[model samples]
Target: LREERIDTVVNFAAESHNSLAVVDPTRFFRTNVLGTQTLLEASRAAGVTRFHHVSTCEVYGDLALDTDEVFTEESPYRPRTPYNASKAGADHAVRAYFETFGLPITITNCSNNYGPYQFPEKVLPLFTTNALDDEPLPMYASTQNKREWLHVLDHCSAIDLVLRKGVEGETYNVGSGIEATIEEIADLVLELTEKPQSLKTIVPDRPGHDRRYLLDATKIRDELAWEPSHGWRDGLAETVAWYTANRGWWEPLKKRAPVSEETAWR
Candidate 1:
């Protein structure tokens, strides 16, 4: 930081997979928890002006699928999975630095992000890529799991807004205020790729899986004047189209981590 005269640090590093975290929580802890602390210390020592931490709404845990509930900035932390627990720990650490050492830090807990260049391991990419190749779209259990989706570009815009106009030591929830089920995403992917719905395959659910995650992003909208410009339907179609047009980008990635039944939980 000193050599480069860096004034800001944005932490986006994480081993962010639910099943992977369940298999080995230590990796998530080391990267998400301890790594965040290390960065916080370095930022404080280096006199960084702004330290922004990008987090996940999973830290607020899941809401009942039948309810109209949504997670907000004031929601209590109730992380169910190892990945989310590690993130919750990191969120606490970011706040601690601000309260204890007076570091100028702001945090944004965002919803699921989908767009071009996303690793094929994630839900949107996995389904889109699989449908493109005429491979089975693995639907975990009943495929009833729901999540709020945000475009990656919109997520970046929210983070940019938080960094520029947000108050230090404050945490914001950034989302599209739109939630969709896993099955719905699969159907959309199949439609976009012109693939048959018969390619959908049922797989066992991950242990300790949360049923739904919906974020109430009123704070960011009212405070920072931030809103997602991309509608979910159009954004998802564009994403699937991008994957279709650029097989070179995701083909090698799929080869590196070939989709399998065991690694199918998204």
Candidate 2:
């Protein structure tokens, strides 16, 4: 950064698979926690004025499906998985730099992202591609596990807003306020791809799977005036089409991903 005269830094690097994290937590810690601390130190050393750390809502842990409660910026951290625990540690480290070293830092914890160019490991692209090829769609422990879906483009927009206009030493929740069950998402993918519902298969769930995750993006909305612009249905349709039309982009990734029957559904 010193040699390049970098003024700002956006940290989005992480080992983000919950299943993989459970099997191998060391990599997650090395990348998400240590990597963040290293980057913060480097930014401070280089005198970077602004640091934006992109996070996930998983750090807030699971919410009861029966409740209306959503994760707010002020929510207490209760990470259940190795992936979320690593990210939560990183979030705290970023704040530590702000408080101790007076570094200008902002963090944005976003919801589930689905869009073009996403790796086939994630649910949306995974199911879409699987259905397109007449492969079984693996459902994790419970199809009832819920998540708030946000298009990647909208997530990017929210990050941009927090990076540019957000206050230092603050955390913002970024979400579309759209929630759906895993089973529902898989069904939708099958419907969109014209595949039979029988293609759905229940697979072993990852360890410590969260029952539900919902985000209250009120802070980013009220303070930064940022909200998701894409409609969920339209965005999902376009995402499925992108995978359908550009199999080459994701096919190679899936090949290298080594999806086993146990973890295929994630």
lDDT of 2: 0.91
lDDT of 2 by residue, 83-174 (tens): 99999999999999999999999999999999999988888988999999999999986889899999999999988888889999999999
Report the number of backbone clashes for model 2.
0
Those runs of model 1 whose alpha carbons end farther than 4 Å from true positions after fitting are 258-266
The lDDT for every candidate, in the order shown, is 0.91, 0.91
lDDT of 1 at 162: 91
Tens digits of per-residue lDDT, candidate 1, 11-38, equal: 9999897878877789999999999999
- In the order shown, the candidates' Cα RMSDs to the true structure are 1.7, 1.7
Q: Once model 1 is optimally superposed onto the true structure by TM-score, how far is the C-alpha of residue 156 displaced, in angstroms?
A: 0.8
Candidate 1 accuracy as lDDT: 0.91
